[model samples]
Target chain A: MTSSDLQEQLNIKALNLLQGDADKIEKLIEIQMENLDTRYCPLYEEVLDTQVYGFSKEVDFAIRAGLVSEPVGKQLISNLERNLSVLYEAMNNKTQAAE
Target chain B: MTSSDLQEQLNIKALNLLQGDADKIEKLIEIQMENLDTRYCPLYEEVLDTQVYGFSKEVDFAIRAGLVSEPVGKQLISNLERNLSVLYEAMNNKTQAAE
Candidate 1:
């Protein structure tokens, strides 16, 4: 394969792996969103924060390594952050209702 | 550049980036080691743990994306962990001395 082909292949693989991780975080957010009626567990917030932190590190490394472009990395992270924000908003509403 | 050349260059870049991050964490450990006389800051421990966790995620991503070999990734993590353990041991000794 040509050099470009190899580069493209690597980029695709990197994006896919990153997306998979992001999906895991998204799944976590979705679970919390669905269980909004249940009492909020503080540990869940910590776990989600840690997961997102780790994932951002991964994306940063990928971008630095030339495996993924900056824009693509930003897109992946923003997608997850948007979902996380939504989950947090729902949790907040539940807390306010309880009060 | 040839495909092989590109691959080699990417591998080196990834390794260098990972080593740079490891060095930052190592610097943190060394600082805490030198300040053993000062009261231990629990915050330092928390920061170190979070940094290591994030760094591990980066190494994992690099390995998964095929930028670095599994052995190389493992070596990077183990080196940091070993230093962290040494720092912890010294901290333990200091605490015992104070008691």
Candidate 2:
């Protein structure tokens, strides 16, 4: 393979790994969303926040290391954040309903 | 550059970027250690923990993405953790002395 081909392969691999991590976080959100009726778990929020923070760091490193472009990295993070916000909004609604 | 050359370059870049991040965290520890005589600040601990967590994530990603070797990535994290532990021990001693 040529240098460009190798670079392309590496970029794709990096993006896939990041997407997989995002999916794990998304699954966490989905689980919490499904269990909205259960008592609100602060620990879940902390874990989610920590996961997101770690993910952003990974994306940032990928960009800095040239494994991923800045635009692509940022988009991945924003997409995850949007989904997270939806989860938070649902949680808030559930809490208000309980109150 | 050849494919192998490109790969080697990326590996070095990834390691350097991780080291740079580790240095930043080390600086944070140094700053906190210098101010140990001042009243203890829980915020510093929180920030340090968060930074270390993020750094570890970056190192993990680098390892997964095939940019850095697992041993090298883990060593970078352990070195930072050691310094962080030293800072925490100093803080604990200071607190005990004050009491």
Candidate 3:
């Protein structure tokens, strides 16, 4: 593979690895949020919001910079959305548990 | 206050809150990495690397957009560096623990 191809491959691999880490972080945030006070919910949510925004921007940058293909970006985004939904459910569960 | 001032103030507040969240996430990643196999360390590190890069970009964007003062951006970046150092120490500790 050419150097450009190698870079694209690395970007794709990084995105996949990032997805896995995002899943793990989501689970960890859920568990931590459960034990913390309600006041911290907004804080945690803000962090996640910033992260999601950042990740989305990075995906777009990767596509525009020709570091990754459109399909790869789309798949990464899909995984991000799925992970976010899981996070939302975890947050809801924590709220229910607190009540 | 002018609308611009209000926006800058909000940005500063968000940066401060983000700093707090970064600290928490650093701790969480540290703890999680301790239990997980060594293979996962690079994955976690990539997520963090991406995050830090994203954050630095955001900070620069904020300054360029006049959403935050240069000093405010500097402080935020400084906080980021501190948190990252702590994270590095955690990673080092994890490696030592595994040895």
Candidate 4:
């Protein structure tokens, strides 16, 4: 296959990997929040925040480069934002509970 | 700082990390090539190829998004391409020596 075709395949593979990792991270965060251990809360928040930020940037970059379609990029960004919000709220609730 | 500034900072940071990692990976590959162990040659080539491809796409995306300047992107790409060529030559020589 041509380089462009290879890039397209890599782009799809990257998107899939990002989505799968996001799902796994969100589920892990949910479980951690339910358990609500103060010690691990910060670590969980850090992981979620870092991964969401990094992945969102990757999606944006892909869209800008025409590696992925705009609609697909938008959807990926929306999902990531949703997950981020959930993580933020969980962190906030934990903080309030601790106070 | 504005979001644009933040993105610029991230772009710089990412570029530095990529360059540093590329340097380290290249050094490792050189050492491995010197040793000429068939067992690890495949693994080293795989790492170098995958990283070069991924980082080149990232540089392209950053340029398209205006996150990095064109000259800077061009320099980065040139460096990566040079490293890749060196790796290819090393691998080819190894194959020839074995044959």
lDDT of each: 0.91, 0.93, 0.61, 0.64
2 or 4, greater by DockQ: 2
**What is the TM-score of each predicted model, taking all chains together?**
0.95, 0.97, 0.39, 0.43
Clashing pairs in 2: none
Residue-wise C-alpha lDDT for candidate 3, range A1-99, written one tens digit per residue: 454455445555545644664575566556655655544455776666666666565555445444457897787767766766776776777679979
Model 2, span A7-97: residue lDDT tens? 9999999999999999999999999988888756868877998999999999999999998999999999998899889988998888788
Q: By TM-score, rank the candidates, best first.
A: 2, 1, 4, 3
TM (chain A) per model? 0.94, 0.94, 0.62, 0.65
Candidate 3: CAPRI quality band: incorrect
Listed models, DockQ each:
0.91, 0.95, 0.04, 0.04
Better structure of 2 and 3 per lDDT: 2
Ranking by lDDT: 2, 1, 4, 3
- Residue B11 displacement in candidate 4 (angstroms): 5.0
| Candidate 4 per-residue C-alpha lDDT over A15-50 given as tens digits, one digit per residue, 9 for 90 to 100 | 675567568767776776667654554676766665
lDDT of 1 by residue, A1-99 (tens): 889999999999998999999998999898888888875686888899999999999999999998889998999999898888888888888889989
A6 Cα displacement, candidate 2 (Å): 0.6
List the pairs of residues colliding in candidate 1.
none
Q: Show model 1 residue runs off by greater than 4 Å.
A: none
TM-score of 2: 0.97
Question: Which prediction has more favorable lDDT, 1 or 2?
Answer: 2
In the predicted model 4, the residue pairs found to clash are none
